[model samples]
Target: MACQREDELQELVDEARKIAYEGKVANYIPALQKQNPEVLSCAITYPNGKCVSAGDINQSFSLQSISKIITLAIVLMDYGVDHVFHKVGMEPTGDPFNSIVKLETSSQAKPLNPMINAGALAVTSMIKGKNAEEKVEYILKFVRKLCNDPDITYCNDVAISEFTTSFLNRSLCYYMKGGGVIHGNVEEIMEVYTKHCAISMNSLHLANVGAVFAMNGVNPVTGERVMPKEVARICKTFMVTCGMYNASGEFAIKIGIPAKSGVSGGIMCSVPGRFGIGIFGPPLNDIGNSHTGMKLLELLQEKYDLSMF
Candidate 1:
């Protein structure tokens, strides 16, 4: 379905863009530093195949931490909930997404949740593949199916940059490996993890993926099951509890939707069975969430009474 532009949404985007200066684009990745911090865009996809968008919706961005939800879904389907949770806890962490203090202080080395960098690395290690290439292909194939676009692929430059600089992620992997929470070559796991995190897409495609989860694992446009209903439930639960890094609780209290955000200033939200929302605004608050995008969502929630509460 053609996405019909909405003036109302455009107004919201304009309002949110004004706060872009309050935040900064992620610079640690090197590749993400090139983004325009003021750029803001949004797209919403419905079960009836209707879509509405505003702002710079065409600009593509890396998935970053948002890919964690997708990879968690894939691994949950490959391995049962029992096996997956055995490796990563379902609880959220109050510390930073990449912090390793809990990994060393916790009773076990298993990551507290899959949304964090440590847990994401552990989950990536579980993807069923003989090598990094095949594992990436498997993830891409699933992402393509969700977007209904076979051309979807990862950003090679971003992948390489993240792979080379992800010393913290590598350390997380080794810590888990030593604890018997994960097994494999550390470099191979890093290769797959970085590539999946670097998977790039515009706001519209991201909205579509969010819709798949909104409809309980069924692709709204294709009317096909993407994953089992239970898997989708687990993924959504995580999104509610841990998706927005450490700000998830405040987000839940305010916006009240199941959503995930990335360091690249992308937010993918599911309004239960209603619709899927995708937003990109490169400037991030101290918590690493899209500063402007969060404002936009707050505006939406206030305007439409969107809170599921």
Candidate 2:
């Protein structure tokens, strides 16, 4: 079965690769800029513990904003719905993920949604830990569980690059601290946020993590409930509403799946009760999603009628 799936998917990969040169790699992060923009890969993990792949599935990349969805789950479990919602909003923002304009304009001064940069940082601050290291450990442990790979860890180069260069994220943290929207040391929160954003993995590992969410919080391979059903539902809802940054609504109408994208050219997609997809195509479209990766998903959706809507 795996062989057949991979063979069939390879055709899609080849087709998708044709557009690989049409987009650009994320250049702001020095580490990310080192990626070859022409590279594209994909993996899909099914509920039955089967995973199939095409292209260079072994390629590793940071999660970037894709980490936002997982952190939200942790916080939701840590403080429950009421407490989590109070710190961050549930509405989607049409602005770019890093825009701080909404933070200043919102009546409550809270981030409009957890998927955006400001909201993700706010959510990261809510992670339970005595300090930055402990918080990072907790997040890594959870991610390792989700990926079903005990060795999964962050890329130091990427983490350091992001931490040092993320001036806008620091600004968001300081602004929120002043508004009483978030508490604790701003630098500590930034440390935890950047490390998690740098968590590195290949497409197969990412697909396994997405499979857990696709099965509604249960790790199909291990039969462990990593998160409650409610938590998973909320996270998936946010992914549909805000996962693609400002392009999420259009993606929903076109692709119709719950998915999250990272500027590192990684996209984790949960097809719900079916399978999960992980794609890495370093070239990014104008809105920051994987250009070739999006085409691959469109091909899959059209071939298999994968839309939930």
TM-score of each: 0.98, 0.98
Clashes of each: 0, 0
Task: Specify the poorest-scoring 10-residue window by lDDT in model 2.
Answer: 1-10
Q: Provide C-alpha RMSD values for all models, in order.
A: 1.8, 1.4
Name the lDDT of candidate 2. Answer: 0.92
State the displacement of the C-alpha of residue 129, model 2, in Å, after optimal TM-score superposition. Answer: 1.2
Write down the lDDT of every candidate, Cα atoms only: 0.92, 0.92
Off by over 4 Å in 2: 1-4
lDDT of 2 by residue, 41-111 (tens): 89989898888899988999999999999999999998999998998999998899999999989976899
lDDT of 1 by residue, 175-224 (tens): 99999999999999999999999999999999999999989999988999
Pairs in steric clash, model 2:
none
Q: Please report, as a residue range, the 10-residue window in candidate 1 with the lowest summed lDDT.
A: 1-10
